[model samples]
Target: MTWTIAGSLAVVPAPTRTDLLAEPVAKALAALADPDAVGVAEIDPSLADTAAFCEAYGSPLEASANCVVVAGKRAGEVRFAAALVLATTRADVNGVIKRRLDVRKASFAPMDEAVSLTGMEYGGITPVGLPAEWPILLDRRVAEAPELVIGSGIRGSKLLISGAALAALPGAEVIEDLAR
Candidate 1:
């Protein structure tokens, strides 16, 4: 969607814009506002799911944001882990993530745990469907895109949302180089 400001000075289109496809992203948007705002787009039922999805929608693979969930120990005793990284950058498994989670080592959450906990497929565990307490670490670069293609809490399809909107999700924190 486009937000325009019309005043005595001049009319200007907002720097950020978001659209609600009749898919995964729409639902996500609703959740973000009152219910949610993320939506999922049903892509070709092929092995190369995301690639196929991109081809169908004329979206580029590089333009997609990858979100991953990690679980590990935090602090000397307290345990915590769960992060979202962009497809462009690697998760700072040894830096901020390690320091933020306060763990010497961190790894991807087990597939079963990821699926069971988030109710999203292995290739589609978005921050939206993650456990309510899960901390969402978003990369700043992801927001640079006019919009981003992301998961809609599912794998059968992909969803699109404004990067800014995704950042606005409750509990989501913006970090630069959150990944390696």
Candidate 2:
């Protein structure tokens, strides 16, 4: 499938570019019902951050999505979840997320914890290959986008996929007002 969202980067079929993806991401892509729908693009690791990536690659900021890890505690148990939101907004962790997780409080998980748990690099975490038990909270805005540039689970690359595909990922749940 041809992706019109490509910026200056060369987009290739993800299944054919597993080297560009983190192990977990590559495995997840291979298991997808339609792996051909996803695309991978090489990038400078230093430009992996949303603003830098968009500016350097000539991609619009609105077409980029960020996946953030959140940790919420209920009683003594901690629950982790991944929130997918447009780069233009922030996840409503204190409100909707906390409520959804049934925790007393919810906050962005520590970088170390997030990276360790997801087996993905910091600034390169994506919902695609998250732990099976972890919920993937996708913002309605993100689910409605035509195509979005997301992390490839590695800093040196990015993934291009449609919102519908993301919404259909295992454990994904489209939530209205997930971001603000």
Candidate 3:
């Protein structure tokens, strides 16, 4: 099926609000507002689940990419970074992240800390909100979708950008099989 933004059929209005106005997702989206990265569309606030969000917006899960921000400890220094992987493929926390941070173990950032550090609401977090110093790992497939609907940096909305544009963000580098 062809992926189209909510308004292609004039069924939904283009998102007037920036996703960051929402929270954790907001902080993530803050970075994309510059260069006007791509067009963003707002959907029902209640449909934030990966599948629901896509269906409501008339996109497929494969067309949606997920961003996860994780905190890992490396040589006694705690570090944070974001992972961009296919929504269908989980981030390789044990393998990729573990090696990347040079840590014994790694996993999703604790909910409380993720919220506190990124200042984004849970379920709303996106890579766009991470600190500039942190690096971003992008799944090669996420770089292929013609257009992707990602968190607006907020759960209340999602942003539309070509996979290429999403991968071009500062600190982003392409990786292969970067997901579980």
Candidate 2 clashes: the total is: 0
**Candidate 2 Cα lDDT to native:** 0.95
Write one digit per residue (lDDT tens) for candidate 3, span 1-180. 233644341222223444324554444444454434455565667887788776665677777788888777877888887888878889888898778877887888888887787766677666665667878888888877677767655566666667787687778877787886
User: How would you encode candidate 2's per-residue C-alpha lDDT over 1-180 as one tens digit per residue?
Assistant: 776677798998999989999999999998999998899999999999999999999988999999999999988999999999999999999999999999999999999999999999999999999999999999999999999999999999999999999999999999999999
lDDT, residue 127, model 1: 65
Per-model C-alpha RMSD: 8.0, 0.7, 3.6
Deviation from native of the Cα of residue 138 in model 2, angstroms = 0.3
Per-candidate clashes come to 27, 0, 8
- Model 1 RMSD, rounded to 1 decimal: 8.0
Q: Candidate 1: where are CA atoms >4 Å away?
A: 1-29, 34-39, 47-52, 55-57, 75-81
lDDT of each candidate versus the true structure: 0.58, 0.95, 0.69
- State the displacement of the C-alpha of residue 6, model 2, in Å, after optimal TM-score superposition: 1.4
Quick one: ranking by TM-score, best first? Answer: 2, 3, 1
